[model samples]
Every structure is written in C-alpha cells, then in structure tokens.
Target: QPTLRKLVGGSSAPQLPDDSVRQLLVEADATNELFKYCEGQGYSLFVAAQPCSYTTQVVAGMIYTVSMSTEPDPGTYYEIKIFKPLPHLEQKARVTEIRMAQR
Candidate 1:
C-alpha cells in the first residue's frame, strides 16, 4: 500500500512528512470496522489516500481523503472514505465522510 503522503501528493503536490503519514495511518486504523467486516466476508481490503475537494466543503480547509476498496467481487466492491483535516490547521480532527455500497 502506498503511503498516504504519496497517494495524496501524486506527482506534483507537496508530500507529507513521514510522521504525518504515520499519523494518518494511525487515524485510519482506528476506524477499521468496515475493513474487519469485509475481511470476515472473505474480501481483501486496499486503502489509500488522495486529495479531495469535497472534504474542503465538509472541513473548511484542506483534507486528506482516505479510501478503502475490496478485491473485485462480481464487478462490485465496497468503498469507505475518511477525511482528515490538514495538520497545520487548528482543527486537528478526523471524520469518516461516507461508507456505502455492499455486494
């Protein structure tokens, strides 16, 4: 799995530090109920982060968007998105934006 920094930074954006990436992973790990559920159902979970504009609307500033996807199953998979505000911001909070679609 690519680090959150790498996923969000892409090829041109600024990269997040190692500590920041670790922090994001920790935060994402704390909310792994969906991952556990998927695993229980015999699916592998893949997670990565990306820059998201919709998160700005929810958080009022830059946000790290983490998405989890499962191995293909009948041309469908589960996806969950988590939003984390930028570290420089005073918010220092995390939010799970959405968890939907099954089967």
Candidate 2:
C-alpha cells in the first residue's frame, strides 16, 4: 500500500505546475470516465480532453482526483473525482464528484 507523505491541499495544488511538480498520470480509463460523465450530465458542447494534474488513493479500489481543462481555456477547469474498482472486481470506473476549480 502506498502512503501519502504530504498532501498538497486545495484545488489549486493540482493545477499544471512547472518541472518541480509531477504531471498527472492520466489513464485512458479515467479519460473515458470523464467523457461518459460529461455526456451523462447533458454537456452537449463538450470537447474531448485529457485531464491533467491528478492524484490517486487506494481504498477497496482506486480513487482518482483530477484537474481538467477543455478547449485550452484557462480558469475553465474542473476538479473531478472518480472511483475505479480493483481489477479483480471487474467493475467499471465511476465518477463520484465534480467540482469547478476556482482558478
């Protein structure tokens, strides 16, 4: 199990940072989850995007918290939370929460 040594608190902590910060390790599954979430929420004009600056935690499965931007628009980012069950469970990823960042 991976333990968090220190947490970069707040939504702003995960924004695109310089070389010092780790880039979000985005997976296709997570991106797919975002697409599904946007569509389900009736976002008719949504753009396809790969969320950046993210973190994950392990519970019964994995929880992904990501920062996303659409259409290259600054301050138009959203903080999304997703839950992915362990592979052995063979469950689909689920979007748990969505918060618009105050960038």
| lDDT winner | 2
What value does the lDDT take at residue 21 in candidate 1?
A: 48
lDDT of 1 by residue, 1-103 (tens): 8565433433324343355544654666624656566667775556532222221223444454433334444335334344566657745444454444554
Best candidate (score: TM-score): 2
Q: List the residue pairs that clash in candidate 2.
A: none
Residue-level lDDT for 97 in candidate 2? 80
Candidate 1 — number of clashing residue pairs?
Answer: 0
lDDT of 1 at 8: 44
> lDDT of each structure?
0.45, 0.60
Per-residue alpha-carbon lDDT of candidate 2 for residues 1-103, written as tens digits (9 for 90 to 100): 9875554442223445333222222333545655666678775436766456766676787766777776567766766777778889976666678766657
- What does the lDDT read for residue 94 in candidate 1? 48
| Candidate 2 regions with alpha-carbon error over 4 angstroms | 1-4, 7-46
Q: Could you report the Cα RMSD, in angstroms, for every candidate shown?
A: 9.8, 7.3
